[model samples]
Target: MRAFVSMLSGILFGFGLALSGMMDPSRVRGFLDIFGDWDPTMAFVMGGAVIVMAIAWRMQKAMNKPVVCDQFSLPGTKLIDARLIGGAALFGIGWGLAGLCPGPAVASLANNLSGAAIFVAAMIAGMVIFRLTERPAQ
Candidate 1:
């Protein structure tokens, strides 16, 4: 049952990405472009997502635990650290250059985009490196 729900959630998320024009690198690039033919549609999409997430987060706080899970899966720490800053900077640079973030990059794999394939490959490599190097949190 949990597996089915997870699969359904992923399908819905992928559909939303496709419907929002996020699957197109050109649309994302246009959003990032401030000088030439800049587009703000993606900003609105992100803003909407943030708003929804904020509401969901608040609602989650009122509940003792998640209904669908055996344990609470929320992050335990809230701190501003070098690792967060560095990761954000790296992500921003890559997004500015390729105009494709993780979600859209994964979606692009189905479309047979070569750049997306490379991006996904590099992203997996980075995750593996981080896993191998980082100490497990206490």
Candidate 2:
């Protein structure tokens, strides 16, 4: 049941990404090119998602346990540390360059976009490198 729900949710998310034209790297790049020719479509998509998730977070505060899990698994830290900032900067650089973060990159694979495979491969390699080189949390 859990696996089914997870798979179904992923499918729905990918479908939504496809429907919103998020599978196009050029469209994402246009959004980042704010001074040149900004595409505000993704801003609307992200705004809609933020609104929905805001409501979900409010509802989560009222619940003691999740419907599909034994307990809520929310983030514990709210710290704005150097590590967090550095990670965000790195992510922004990569996003600005490739214009396809993990979610859309994976979703673009379905359409067989020209650079999607290379991007996904690099992303996986980065993850593996991080896992291998990461120091234990103190």
Candidate 3:
């Protein structure tokens, strides 16, 4: 049941990304290109997501356990560190250059097989590298 719900949610999210034109690298690039023909569509999408997530967070706070899960598995860390900042910088650079983050890139694989495949492959590689190189939390 939990797996089914997770799959359904992922499908819905991918569909939303496709409908919002987020699956298109050009649209994402336009949104990031502040000095060029800037696009505000992604901003609206992100704002909507933030609002929805805020409501969801409030609802989650009131619940003891998730409908499909035993308990909520939220992030434990709250402190910002050098690794976080460095990872964020690298992510921003990659997003600016390729105009596709993980979610959108995976969603885009249905339409753009080659590029999305490459991006996903590299992303996996980066994750592996990070896992191997990162020091255990003190």
**Best candidate (score: lDDT):** 3
Better structure of 2 and 3 per lDDT: 3
lDDT of each: 0.90, 0.89, 0.93
Query: Compared with the true structure, what per-residue lDDT tens digits does model 1 show for residues 1-138?
Result: 888889998999999999998888889999999899999999989998999999998999898887778868867786988878999999999888888889989988998579789999999999999999998777
Candidate 2 lDDT over 54-94, as tens digits, reads: 99999999999987889888778778989899989988988
> What's model 3's lDDT at 40?
92
lDDT-sorted candidate list, best first = 3, 1, 2
Q: What is candidate 3's local distance difference test score?
A: 0.93
> Model 3: which ten-residue window has the lowest total lDDT?
75-84
Ranking by TM-score: 3, 2, 1
Q: Pick the candidate with the highest TM-score.
A: 3
How well does each candidate superpose onto the true structure, as a TM-score?
Answer: 0.88, 0.93, 0.94
